[model samples]
Target: MENKHPYSELGYKIFFKIKPFLKKILRIKVVGVENIPLEGGCIIAANHRSHFDPPVINIVSPRPVIFLAKKELFEVPVLGWFIKKAGTIPVRRDSRDTAVIKKSISLLKEGFVIGIFPEGSRARPGEFRKPQPGVGYLIEKAKVPVIPVLIEGTDKVLPVNSKFPKLFKYNIDVIVGKPIKFEGISSYEHIAEKVMHEIRKLKGERHG
Candidate 1:
């Protein structure tokens, strides 16, 4: 069957082209990749520590992921062009944007995978920010499986205030946890907490 999902072939191609270079420059170790389902719509809810989080997840994902990016990134020049072409959805961080919610639901129905950082923004390394309710809303609305992921060591490569990454100097670890599906409960906050709990477990950290 012809693909109906909105994954950009050009984006996947670009990712593959740059994958080798990224790998050569940074030591990235991916664990429990099998936890990611091979097909269908799923949400990858992860912790964010650095700007590199998105690309790292995209590169390691078994399938193409449509990221929910902060709206500001979409206003930049070349970065904007790439993200738009890659079929990323822009979200305004200051409020709960219904338009983004609707768009995400529509995409999920079309069998697209979405990568979301529930913490909403980058937090200090080894610490997690409280997850936003949007993630739970998406899970409840779309009724898709969620995979909790923990990313480590990216902060060292690109610290919070640094503009450029320290090339070839850091080892990054991405740990993928088993999928969590909400069978009946629909409270957005509760669901978000559950997802965050799983991520914390993977990171070997206490719940926030």
Candidate 2:
């Protein structure tokens, strides 16, 4: 991936280096990692909660996961640099950014794993938000396998607008849902709904 910034990826390197510090604060237990592809272009569509979601996914997945972070987040000088270095794409939510789309597609073709938060935006108190359908489009267009990841207990660890994660060692479980068949899928909506169902079923209890 071509990143314009020198420090865009610095965060990833630094984050990984200091992750041991987080170990004491967070009890992150990931399961079914074998469900993810060892290599090749595969999509990881997961639920969004804390800022830690992307980092957590990268830590456990054997393959490198390219996260589609919001474009604005990368605008900051240092933050932008590291985001690009981490191979994350900047997406413009309201309007389609051709540059970002092209870059993401290119990365997938290169056999790199891509991560997307299908919820589009963070979840609220009401019903779960519907996916933007872009992921389904990518799934069919890229013709790659889709892996649904259900993240439970992240919100409890750190809710929206909370600067620091709770000090307590909360149980954060990640469930890698089975890869669903993509051959017969004709529409993006169909596939989007399918992925949501898989995540819902895979969401487990906070503990145990």
Q: Write the per-residue lDDT of candidate 1 for residues 20-41, one digit (tens) a residue.
A: 6776678888888899999888
lDDT of 1 at 111: 82
lDDT of 2 by residue, 9-68 (tens): 556567667666665468777788899988788889888877778877877777668888
Candidate models: Cα lDDT each:
0.86, 0.76
- Against the true structure, candidate 2 reaches a TM-score of 0.83
Error of 2 at 120 (Å): 0.7
Off by over 4 Å in 1: 1-7, 17-21, 184-186, 205-208
Clashes of each: 0, 7
lDDT of 2 at 109: 81
> Cα RMSDs of all predictions?
3.5, 3.4
